[model samples]
Target chain A: MTEKGSAFLDLMGGEVFRDGSQGVKIRLTIEPHHTNPRGVMHGGVVASLLDEAAALAIKELLGLRPQDSGPHLLVEMNVSFLAAARPGDTLEAEASVLRMGRRVAFAEAQVHRGKTLIAKGRFTFVMQHD
Target chain B: MTENLSQLGIKGEAARSPFSGFIGNVLEERRPGYSRLSLKIEARHLDSSGRLHPGVLATMMDSALGAALRDVRRKDEEGIPGGTVAMDMMVLQVVREGEELVAEGRLLRRHGALAFGEAEVKKRGDGTLVACAYFVFAIGRGSPR
Candidate 1:
């Protein structure tokens, strides 16, 4: 499945792809606007990508459609920046669900530039049901 | 020296980073060990459900934390050179569009080639805490200005 129509995601220009029973992947090309003063991708952008990927993984794990389910609130997130990604680089963020409970879910994601790991994140989300 | 610090503000040419500018982060104040910034929620800052996006909050917190460290280091005769290595953030309340939020960051400590900081995001009107975050940064030697 391909995710679309999120204003914030559109602003970031990420392409989402879901693999059957595996997880979700978000692909983004580093633009000049994404760079920080050091001319590399901003750490916050990396964190955002990690968070989104992880959240999407949880959504897939529960088999909930975006429109049908209630909003999933991100309770906590931890990100570790391993390396810097420069402009013009293509980074792919892949995520998987670690555990899913009745109301809370745990997921993790890693951003990579080919073999180079750029960042990783773990997320805790409160899954609301309608 | 003060001019350089002022350049980090919204009216100055140096302002924040490109990403910060793109996200409409406005630097309100910066001083030793502390920094303040604000952002007005827009349509582009919301998720599909019309709620404030977590990524936007993370961006604000990350920028505020880094700015606090940068403010403190600006006083050194050398220059400021560093980057965020890790961050942990928790959302205390959910925000929505049209809410203006302010983030205040405080540098907690600096050790050998490392710095620690924390930040709080609050609603501009009622000062309700929206989020809190902690950051770890690696300090280096370079010409920041």
Candidate 2:
């Protein structure tokens, strides 16, 4: 993993679910730091997970190359949360590439707990040029 | 001074409530998506051209997506265990600082292991469409590795 990758993994404060050539999976314990006042995981946390997963997915598709300090830029995304996440709940996010192109990469991700679908999204990242 | 912002419950409460943040504030149901969030657009939240920062709009849209999915599950009383990851997104509008905007995200489709959704952000009061996005989420267990 890249140094930035390792640092991001540390910042997520979650467990790993899947680590493969395609992408990485991460799990988080719903805590006050990850939730809003209503007892659910904060949306920003969700977005952060999405951003990380999307970037990682692209990196994996790119074959773990050391090109630049910046990995990828999130060009755009759409996401939906299906249920409320509470403190102590296990939240996992997994990602993979749908399409990897020269200038952009398309990816998909899911977050769930034991078959209970919480949220899912798709993102596009523009490859940073040197 | 910043602590008081949390008390008002207008500053992204769903992401900070007790039940959800404090006691599962009920205000979220009414807002639905980005419109519900008390979005604070400031000079810092804008781009160099004096428009709402794409990051700020992105953050708001991401929040709306999470809220919309949460809202759907709230209707069924089913607990959402996993968090969402953005698979892809597109921004179609530009906003400026001091300009009020509202966001709306809705669930479009759900399969056995995946879910689909879209979001829209617009200028509040004037109802000017600003941006829209689409997302895919994996619904299961464990953490990101």
Looking at candidate 2, what is the lDDT of residue A66? 19
- The top-ranked prediction according to TM-score is 1
Docking class of 1: medium
The best candidate in terms of lDDT:
1
Candidate 1 lDDT by residue in tens digits, A15-105:
7876564666888999988876666788878988887777667766667553223347898999999988888899989888888887988
Tens-digit lDDT track of model 2 for A71-116: 4556676667666677778877778888877787788877787688
- Local error of candidate 2 at A94, Å? 1.2
| Predicted chain B of candidate 1, TM-score versus the true chain B | 0.82
lDDT of 2 by residue, B2-121 (tens): 122324464345444422222122223333322244454555443223444344455565555655655434333354455454534466565655667666667777565455677667
What total of clashing residue pairs does each candidate reach?
0, 72
How high a TM-score does candidate 2 get? 0.51
lDDT (Cα atoms) of all candidates against the true structure:
0.79, 0.55
Q: Identify the runs in model 2 with alpha carbons over 4 angstroms from their true place.
A: A1-12, A15-22, A65-71, B1-145
Candidate 1: misplaced stretches above 4 Å?
A: A18-21, A65-70, B1-14, B74-81, B141-145
Judge the docking of candidate 2 as incorrect, acceptable, medium or high.
incorrect
